[model samples]
Target: MEQSLYPVEFLHFGIHLKFELTETGIFLKICVVNFSVLGLFFHRPLALNLKAQPGENVTLSCQAPDGVDIEWSRTDLEELQYVFLYRDGHIDSDYQHQSFKNRVELKDKEMKNGNLSVILKNVKEEDSGTYECRFKAAGEGRRKRAFIKTKPISTIQLEVADPDPGELSGCRLNLNSLTGFYFMLEADPEQTLCVD
Candidate 1:
């Protein structure tokens, strides 16, 4: 009599295994290789830069899907500061920082259209920093209940510049000039002279 062997392949949970079957019985060869791991995915965050003058209102835009729990935080600070937090179809102000209190607002009506942006009123020099927008999909569970895992969707770098005095006088000053120029003239004692 003659004996023959056949090769068999099996794949389970991203792991590949091979086996050999003969006329007498079955033989097991443990060959395990993983191509992908469960729950290990990559997500690239979007970058946004914004510049505004002092006392100006700025809106930090974060485009995410509708009905997701969104949170805005200042990551450039010494400690992670919560700017705004929206969850369960409402804004949670208890976790917001004192500096951002009563100054942040969300476009509640626009959330239906996937606009998770927040408006920061009266931007100050202190507000210039890197802000991160994170989102947590509904029904998503983390490995630990104490550790709330969220995914970063967007990052915004804000810059606030002082208002130019010449701009208030309806004069367009060339700010690119490296050399400062001065003008002197004989005027009344009550007159004042200002140099930018």
Candidate 2:
């Protein structure tokens, strides 16, 4: 197998990219990144999938250091829309979104075995959104925890929907309407019938 640079360049939002083409696949390279704005594209989280029906309990799963606190947030909502927050060994509701005030909880209060999953009780359609779980590990020999950086542990795409309501027109669209056919019924005169 051989690989060579494609001789192409891409400069978007101050970040330059060079793509390399190979016999088997294409590889992308990030040449530069802008510091003025948040580099979100370069720091995406690990994605997970979850599905649940409305009115059912949903779990946005994540796991990290056993003792570190975790925060659950939704990206589709406004910035800093903390879906659920746990810090300093307890749940913090100060900045939690109003709608999630009483509907969210930690699956394991102690985060045993590094389980940082959250439980959303009685989920609604509105709950369907992208969720991110982050954790901040404290520095060694530090007696206090600080918000230095919240590294993402996982990103979950939650889908809260009700079962499909069966199609009920009390009649079927035979779909034979487009094509007309002439047929004889009981040896009678030929008649054209198109079922719609």
Candidate 3:
């Protein structure tokens, strides 16, 4: 299935993802030079705004290619912000912040298919801040062994609010990541309202 070069995927986060169909396998080649396209064309804020009530569980989403080391933390909590760290195929608890000692965990411990999202349990008002996920990408081209620390690959502004009387029970949040789209289906025993 050798196909001609063409733009076959959605343009996400200013990065142009070109997927080529070849006999060997479908290859994804990302052009970082076009990072400017995001601001130049969309004129939109990069951080995704999300809201959750205190005591509710929320997931801060992130995605990157496999083989990359990922770090999840609260950008606002500078004093003790290291939320979760995964490297060398295991969680590194040595550097994790005490506040997040037992409150945060990876959605998928295996991280299969590059799902780097973290589930923050028991949300608090103090946790209302910018949650960022960064990845250490392998150096491109000839310097494959070298590591490139990218700018905050994904930033999530989590607003912990207090639910009013008769407030809704569940909410669905959808956002695109550096490498793919992430969506969570909240518990809806009666009916699930699709987020369009």
Candidate 4:
């Protein structure tokens, strides 16, 4: 014969619950608690932030106190694609974008700390945009958008030249970097590289 035992009594500071069992081994119980006390135990969940730099890797992480569902997507597209998703401390699907299929990876697949971080490798200039990370708890949901930009680069050039010594030795002087104009120490303003 099979038997099942369950709680049968629920009691509060001022109230009480009772439990009973039958010959078949079936048991039941009741629970009672102060409304204020239950409310005090309830708490708001924490959210995760995502960030990245261009030509570098970016991770959009979503964390929940109780392993809530997490979804990632881009906002500009008419049809949203699921970059990745997590729930109950596990990856839900293998679905991913073609451009990101091989380059994308998940850091905390175990969801040990409710962390769902999606890492994108070798970010490109086109990837400089916004990303969305959403979390769903029961029937409630919240979302966050992160903007990514490209890293800074330095560009420089150098050149050497030799002009006619006869043209450079006279009183006339030339400054070629900013423009093709020239100036003379003893010449009038009109004679100094004037258009007329």
Best by lDDT: 1
Count clashing pairs, candidate 4. Answer: 10
Clashing pairs in 1: none
Identify the runs in model 1 with alpha carbons over 4 angstroms from their true place: 1-44, 78-80, 108-110, 139-148, 163-196
In the range 20-138, model 1's lDDT, one tens digit per residue, is: 89898877777776652223223456688988877888888876655566778888543434898776667777757899999999855558666888999999999999888877653
Q: Which should have the higher TM-score, number 2 or number 4?
A: 2
lDDT of 2 by residue, 1-196 (tens): 2221211112225667898998989888557765432222222345788877778888888866555556788887665558987776788787788889999998987788878899999999999888888765422232232321454668889998865544221222343455754332222124233332
lDDT per residue as tens, model 3, 1-196? 1222211122334556678899999988665544211211111213678899889899888866555577887766554348887766677787577878899999988788868889999998988888788765322232322222445667899999875545566655666575454545454455455544
TM-score to true structure, per model? 0.56, 0.56, 0.56, 0.40
Mind sharing the TM-score for model 3? 0.56
Q: How close is each model in CA RMSD to the real structure?
A: 15.6, 19.9, 16.5, 20.6
**Residue pairs that clash (backbone atoms under 3 angstroms), model 4:** 7-28, 7-29, 8-28, 8-29, 8-30, 9-29, 9-30, 10-17, 10-30, 10-31
The weakest ten consecutive residues by lDDT in model 4 span 150-159
lDDT of 4 by residue, 62-181 (tens): 444333556655544334355555544455455545566566667665666755556777766555444565554422322323211111111111111222333332255666676776
Off by over 4 Å in 4: 1-55, 87-95, 138-196
